[model samples]
Each structure stands twice: as structure tokens, then as C-alpha cells.
Target: MERKKKTGFARYINLVNLGVFVVVTSVSLPIYWLVISSLKQPVAIGASPPQYIPSPFSFANYQQAFSQYGFSQYFINSMIVTVAATILVLGLGSLAGYGLARLPMRGKTTIMLTLLVISLFPGIAVIPPLYLMMRTIGWLNSYQALIVPYTAFNLPFAIWILRNYFLGLPKEMEETGRIDGASPLRIYWSIILPQALPGLFTAGVFTFTACWTEFLMALTLNNSNSFRTIPVGIALFGTPFNIPYGTIFAASVVAVVPIGILVFVFRKSVVSGLTSGAVKG
Candidate 1:
């Protein structure tokens, strides 16, 4: 009887795993098709039956996007803004999170709730004010226009994640550092921060992705062709009358490739942070 029950449990687990695999594959099909379609000739892309395989695969679409559409400059602009914003978000968020988690404070819950509310505001809602502010500061059409907003928008979630991770850590760690005559900042910088690697990586990845794909503010704040990012560059990938689907799809793939690599590289850290943050504190 016991062996049979165990066998039944194993079967249930297998069923659940199979269900998950099916769901994942179902969701991934469109993305997979988009990628494959980007490599096809324009004629093959518009074929009657839809060619799943590229008849004559070529990098023509990518070449057109990079050379004709000015994706190279846009890509560089994107990298600058995304990297700067991610760094700012991680630094500020981790510091703020550490303070909230470890330091004695009043109305901490209220403060945290306020931050959550701020983050909940839609990006569109703040565009007018942010645009005006940037114009006043002479920052319009500059990298700061994108970087600053990205950092501000991403900081709340970064802080929430880092604060939770910090709380989950044992107070004894800080106390032990204090016993060694270490300053609070020293403890955080030298000891606490190192142990928070997984959480940092998780927050960094989130901030980077958000900064990378952001479009509305990037569009609203900058009007110059020289300052456009990948999303904006891809959006303008055609004449007034014609939209090139294959070229746009290729650009889309290029836009997403960095994010995919980032996730793959730091996947273990992300999983660790998520698991630890979920259970601890």
C-alpha cells in the first residue's frame, strides 16, 4: 500500500511537470516564430502559407537595421542609459534598503508604503511633468533624460527587494561586526553587501531590463535623431507608407538579445535571491 501511494505521488509530479512544459512551449512559440521570421527573405516572409524555415537565410534585415536605420547609434545610446540607470538604481536602492532594514526608524511601514505608491504611478502620468522639468534643466535630448527617469522608476522595486533580503539576514552578522568595532557603514559595505550578492544581481537584472525596454519616456523626453534609443529607432524603421516587418522583427531580436544573455548569465543568482527573499524575513 505504501509503495503504491509513493508511485501515485510520483505520477502526479510528473503530470504537473508535463503541464508546465506544455504551457511554456505554448507561450514561447510566437517569440520563436518572430526570431525565425527575422532571418527569412522578405518574399519568404510574406509567402502564402508562411514559411517556418528560411528558404535563403540572410543577415540582410540586420544589416539594413544597423546601417540604414541607424541602430548602431541607438544601440550605443541605449547601452549608456541602461547601464547608468541600473548602476544608480542598485546603489541608491541597496543603500536605502539597508537603512530601512537595519536602522531604527519611525513610520518605516508608512515610508515603504509611500514608495510602493510612487512606483505604482503609470509612466504616462508623469511624462508631462518630467518632460517639463528636463526642459527647464536643459537636460532634454541628453542621456540624463532617460537615465534619471529610469533610475527613479526602478528604485522602489529595487529597494523593496534589497530591504527584504537584508531583513532576512541574521542580525547577529551586523552585531558581530559591531563587536569588532566596525562602523555601521563599514559593516554594510564590507560584510553585509558581499553576502547580499544574489539579491544585488536580481535587482540589477530587473533595473537593467526596465531601463533597456523603456520607450515612452525615451520618446517623450528626446526629440533629436542622435539621441534615440533602440525602441524608438525600431519604431521609425520604415517610410511613411510602408512598414518593413522583417526588418523590424530583426531589430526586435537585437533589442532583446542582451536581456536574454543577462538573464542566462545571472540566472542562478536570480533564482537564489527569489527563493531566499520568498522564505526569509
Candidate 2:
């Protein structure tokens, strides 16, 4: 009877898990449908009782999108912006975080609080001022317009993330480095940074993702086709007689490739960094 009860309990748990999986899968159907329909013609997608599967898979959309839209150039612009932003966040955020966490500064709390408060404002609200500043500097419609401003905007949040993780770290590590005759930069570079991999990776991955999918800022800052990013390119697919559904979908899928790969590569760091932050004071 005890063995039977144990078996029944295990079976019940398995059934519950299956039910949950099915529900989650059902919720994801629309997104899956969108991706699938991106491979089909607009007419087929607009038809009643929409087709989930393409009758004949097509690469024409991808070809046309690349050939006509300068999607390749847009992709390159995105890559440059994302890479530069990620590197800046990692280096600058880490250094700033280490200083804030370890080094003493007069009125540090007041300044840190001010920065944190300013950082909390939504990016949309800052757009007007940011655009004006960029314009004054004659950076409007250039990659520099996006790169420099985005780094500044994203820096504070990255600083906070790294600072929290740095604060969580015990001072014993830095002390050990000091006893070994390490200077501040040496300690940060050789000792503290190596151990802070998870935090740095978390910041880097987040920055990369943000920089990649930044639609409003990219759209507002750039007007020319050659300077546009993937999101902006995708947005232009709407048309009167020929809505380019397939092309948009294909581009979107391509856009997701880098984000997906980055997440896959650094997923471990994300999980660890998050769990550490939560469990610590």
C-alpha cells in the first residue's frame, strides 16, 4: 500500500507538470504563429482561420529584404552600437562600481542617491533633452549620436548592478591583493574583476540586448536608411498593396539570432548574478 501510494503521488506530480507545460505552450502559440506566418505571403496570413504552416517555404523575402532594404548595413550599424555600448558598460560600470563600493568619497551617499534617482526616470521622458543635446553637438543622424548618448544613459543602471554585486563581495579578497603589494588598479584588474565575472557578464549581456533592440531611440535619432537599425528596418515593411510580412518575419528571426546566442552563452552568469543579488543583503 505504501509503495502504491508513492507511485500514485509521483504520477500525480508528473501529470501536473504536463498540464503546466501544455498551458505555457498554448500561451506561446501567437508568437510561434507570428514567426511561422512571417514565412508566408501577406494574403495567406490575412486569410480567415490563419495558416500556421507555410505551404511552400520561401527564402525570397530574406533575399529581397537584404537586397532592397540595406538590411546588411543596418545590421552592421547595430553591431557597432551594441559592441561599443557593451564594452563601455563593462569597463566603466565595473570601475565606477568598485570605487563606489570600496573607496571613500565625501557626500558619497548623497551623490549615489542622486544618480540612482536620475537613472530611475524612463528613457521616453529624457528623449526631448537628449535629442536637443545630440542636435547641438551636430551628432544627429550619425552612429555617434546613438553610441555616446546610449552609453551615458545605460551607464548608471550598469553601475548600480555592478555596485550591488561588488558590495556583496567580501573585502578580504582586496585585502589579500593589497598584502601581495597590488595597487588599486592592479587589485581591480588582477583580483577583484576576475572574481566578479558573473556580475560583469550580467551587465554586459543586458547592455548588449538593450543596445540591440533599442527601437525608439534608434528611430528618433536616425532618419537615413543606411544608419537605421533592425527594428527600424522591420517597421518600414507596412505597405498598401504589398505588406512585406515574410520579409519582416525573416529579418526579425535574423535579429533574434544574436540575442539568442548571447543569452545561451551567458545564461549561467545571469542566473548566478540574480540569485546572488536576491540572497544577499
The C-alpha TM-scores of every prediction are 0.95, 0.88
* Model 1 Cα lDDT, one tens digit per residue, 212-269: 9988998999879999999888888898898888899999999999999999999999
1-281: candidate 2 lDDT, tens digit per residue: 99999999999999999999999999888678767876776567677777768877667777877897778988998999889888987899999988988887888677678778877868898788888988898888898888886788788878888888888888999999899899999999988898889988888888898889989899888878878888887888667786777778778888988998999999999878767741343
lDDT scores of the candidates, listed in order: 0.91, 0.84
What is the Cα-based TM-score of model 1? 0.95
List where candidate 2 sits over 4 angstroms from the true fold: 1-23, 238-241, 278-281
Every model: Cα RMSD to truth: 1.6, 2.9
Error of 1 at 166 (Å): 0.3
The lowest-lDDT stretch of 10 consecutive residues in candidate 1 is 272-281
Query: At residue 32, what lDDT does model 2 achieve?
Result: 85
lDDT of 1 at 194: 95
